[model samples]
Target: MKQSPATPLPSPKERRRLREAGSLTQAQVAERVGVTREMVRAWESGRTNPRGRKREVYAKLLGTLAEEEEPRRPEVTEPQETLVEPAPPAPPLTPAQAFDALYAFCAPALVRQAYLLTGRRELARESVERAFQLAWQRWPEVAVDRDPAGWVRATAYEYALSPWHRFRPRYRHPEAPPADASDRALMAVLLRLPTPQRRTLVLYDGVGLDLPETAAETEASTPAAAGRLMNAREAIAARLPELSDPAELHRRLTELAATERLRAAKPPVVRTGSERRARFWTRAAIAFTVALIGTTALTVRTAPTHYEPPIAPGAEIQGVPERVAQGPLSEAEVDLREKLRGEMTSGPVRLTPLSR
Candidate 1:
């Protein structure tokens, strides 16, 4: 069997100092390393050592943080000759205990994440619940994944983005939209974006995922995801012009996600096979129609119009208007002629009465 490496991890005490020096909280470090804050605290306190791939990830993430902050590295210490003490063995978590652990730590944050994608509170809750339900069904496989929470999170994001949910019954509250005008405007712009841009922005900004993870979640290449993110950010900046920097936008999104309180709804009744198929097809049709309308609208909005102003009856002809005859004899024309006989007609019109 291939062996896990024996390379040393950062010492827990040293890591804690480094994390603090980087102005990172335990939770932030945990997120960067794809672990829970509790686990981060445990590692910092020397209660547990991250093994295998996790140790490697931890080391790399900490190394990056150290580089960013330019924290001083600790000097190597001489090994002590005294006998080492072995720590007591920890109890293994049963399936239920494991599920509870993952769920409790991840549910609130995942709900916030789902809300960013779906923009519907009940749908977000349902999406998260559906992911957890699947996790419960395959706890064995999930528990062994390198990042179990990441798996569940990816499923939740997919569920939130499912087109069928748009047609599903909504449990919308009267005051569901954000109360702040700026927030409401920002959300309006976000929800209007194409699915790719919205998903990339939500994952990159709202969930604090790095570019690679955002790209993976959106099933896009790094450059493609980066383009989507840039487009989304530009749209947002256009709407929220006060956000002078990307960090401020990220902070605003974080606050917005927290403000989006997604309440749970009662479980929906099971559908028959035919009804399920019908729902799927109906949603597919609606999505297709919406795409068509969006394309047409975009074309119409971008195409220029050539307007022709209305011309009055006596307005000039296409090239040059025909000159009026010198000997015109109509009543109005003769009256004008008699009037022109007066010297005032030689230049601009005058108010003097014409001789009878």
Candidate 2:
């Protein structure tokens, strides 16, 4: 059974950020969520809040924000080391060269992000590598993008969260939590939060995303995202008060996460740019051929034909002649016939017994 978020509503600031991240106006958000524009404004201004299904609808209206804000960079989530690391010195490089440089720069961080979302080492590597493969496949598009790293990061996270990866053979049975009592307790508490709350907490604190970005990823209104984070943090704090600070909580998770040491995963399936186009054309050609053949067969089956009756070699029948009757028999012929008839019809003549 699914659990509902407990004990908090999102903040107005979170709500506003969600609206902006989604590129939706107050009116549009209000209409979709079954409220007035003023009500939406009130929510954003921290004056009021929707609850229950309406709140969920508001959250869902922001669902496609990730796709909408493609060019914007996600808030910096780099570790202190990655932040201090210097970029390669200025040098002219080909498209492949630049992207390779990019891959080396971003791969480690991206993998870590995936790991937080997936909670498995191999799955994380697979998610990040798959995302990079896609980046390579669309290098031309990635090349011109203002934030290629962000694009890849977004893609990696998308894959990591996919239900497909969860169903992989290795994941069919979830691994037991760490043996440490604290880690086990933390994991148990995190699991108890609603799915959205857990994901929101991870994205905001674990992944170091700002509110708007977290809202975008979680498909929640900014306020809703904030509310989720608040609820999650409060819930965790209730169990472990010393680590009430979100940062401390995240740092502890990192320690538990760092202990996982699985081998690298195989690369995800990625087709070349041309291969995608070729696959589409092949399917289209097959469909057209099948439709043409079906049409031809139907036409032939239903076509009208002129049919001629077949005649047997000797089956002719003769026609009958018209009848011709004499008007009446002549009187002498009639008398003769009558006399013969009387003679035939008469009984034996009686001769009176003598003249007695």
> Best candidate, TM-score-wise?
1
Colliding residue pairs in candidate 2: 14-222, 14-223, 15-222, 15-223, 18-222
Off by over 4 Å in 1: 1-8, 11-18, 21-87, 171-175, 261-356
lDDT of 2 at 215: 87
Over the stretch 305-337, how does candidate 2's per-residue lDDT look in tens digits? Answer: 877677958966688676887788899999999
Q: How accurate is candidate 2 locally (lDDT)?
A: 0.72
Find the candidate with the highest lDDT and give its number.
1
Q: Give the Å error, residue 225, model 1.
A: 0.7
Among all windows of 10 consecutive residues in model 2, the one with the lowest summed lDDT is 262-271
| TM-score for candidate 2, residues paired by index | 0.49
What is each predicted model's overall lDDT from 0 to 1? 0.76, 0.72
lDDT of 1: 0.76
Candidate 2: deviation at residue 33, Å?
A: 39
Mind sharing the TM-score for model 1? Answer: 0.54
